[model samples]
Target: MNVSNLCVLTVTVICMVLAWSEPSKACGSCTCSNGVVMSCPNIVQISLRSSGLTNLSGSAFQNNKIVTNIDLYGNQLVHLPAGLFKATTKLQTLNLRYNLLVDLPDGLFKATTELQTLDLDDNPLVHLPAELFNATTKLENLYLSRVQLDYLPAGLFDAITRIKVMYFWGNKFDHLHAGLFKATTELESLYFVRNQLVDLPDGLFKATTKLETLDLKENQLVHLPVGLFNATTKLRKL
Candidate 1:
């Protein structure tokens, strides 16, 4: 081929490549007043901390298929539209701390089965639906500190058996039901500090045999049940 023709072909190819590779549509806020949709095909992480967002539209995450991490900390989100994360199947880390969320839709994390770390601290979550964590089998760390969690349904953690670290500090629960951690036998570090627990049922920690560190400080425990920690032989700190 002639040199002039080759140069022209190269330029044409470069232009075609650039046209196909549009810039990512990642936005740092969801307070869209003009009905703008948030869709970014190639973005891997999104950080929208302290954006003053009060609500998220249902399609907030639609078409954002490849995102793996999302941080929405310190927002005023009171309710998340249903299926907000339905398309974010590749999500792994989600931090929603310091939001005004009181309840989350059932199966909110269903599409995020690969989620490993989830932080819901400082939300006024009164009810955590059963099976909410059913799809997050790979979850390793779960933070619920400073959330007004009064009770948890049975089998709440039945599917997240791979959890390694958990924090439930500064809640309003007065008692822990038996077999609550039956499926979390692989759990390592547990924090229940600054809660209102008065007592734990016998064999409460039976399934957490691999427990290494347990923090139960700042509770109203009048007495600990006998043999509660007998099964947790590897427990180093209490």
Candidate 2:
């Protein structure tokens, strides 16, 4: 073969090798090397369930700009450093269930604007920052069950106007704000079971016109408001 043709062939072979190696290096593991997670451009999912992870560095996901799903369930993590997900701008699903987390840092998801589902179930979280989800405007499903929370700040869900399913079960909250679900007009299923609720405010579901299932079982509620469910025209369960 001529020198020019051989050079083109060599380049093609190198490109083919790189294309095959990127996914092979990142397909089944959370980190490609040295605890740095998802450094590959084609990798979109990272699963590190029950890996005994206690802590993560702030630059853990620094190279995962296009990662969409991350599952770190059943770990021993008590806290996450700030800006951990600063590079994961297209991240959509994040599952941190069954961890030892007590509280989350502020603005953790500030750069993760496209986040859709966030699962924080079975953690020891005692409080959540009001602006935690401010940048996650596309968030839809939120799982906060068994987090040991007693109160949620007002306007916490104000920016998540497209939220659909929310799980607030097994909490210590005795009451909820009347306008808690006002911005979640597209809310469909709401689970508030096993809480310390004594009463519900009027117009609680006024803006949640599309709410369908509302599970308030096992609470200390004494009576329902006169028109609490008036605006929840599609409510099928209570």
Candidate No. with top TM-score = 2
Error of 1 at 208 (Å): 0.8
Span of ten consecutive residues with least summed lDDT in model 1: 25-34
Query: For residues 1-238, what per-residue lDDT tens digits would candidate 2 score against the true structure?
Result: 2223322332333344345766454233332344454345665666766766777778677776787988888988999887889999999999999999999999999998999999999999998999998999999999999999999999999999999999999999999999888899889999999999999999888999999999999999998989888898899988
Model 1 C-alpha lDDT per residue in residues 21-121, reported as the tens digit of each score = 54232132222222433343445666667766777766656655887888889988887766889998999999999999999999788889889999999
List TM-score per model, in order: 0.84, 0.86
- Alpha-carbon lDDT, every model: 0.80, 0.83
Top lDDT hit: 2
**Model 1 steric clash total:** 0
- Candidate 2: list runs displaced more than 4 Å: 1-38
- Residue-pair clashes per candidate, as listed? 0, 0
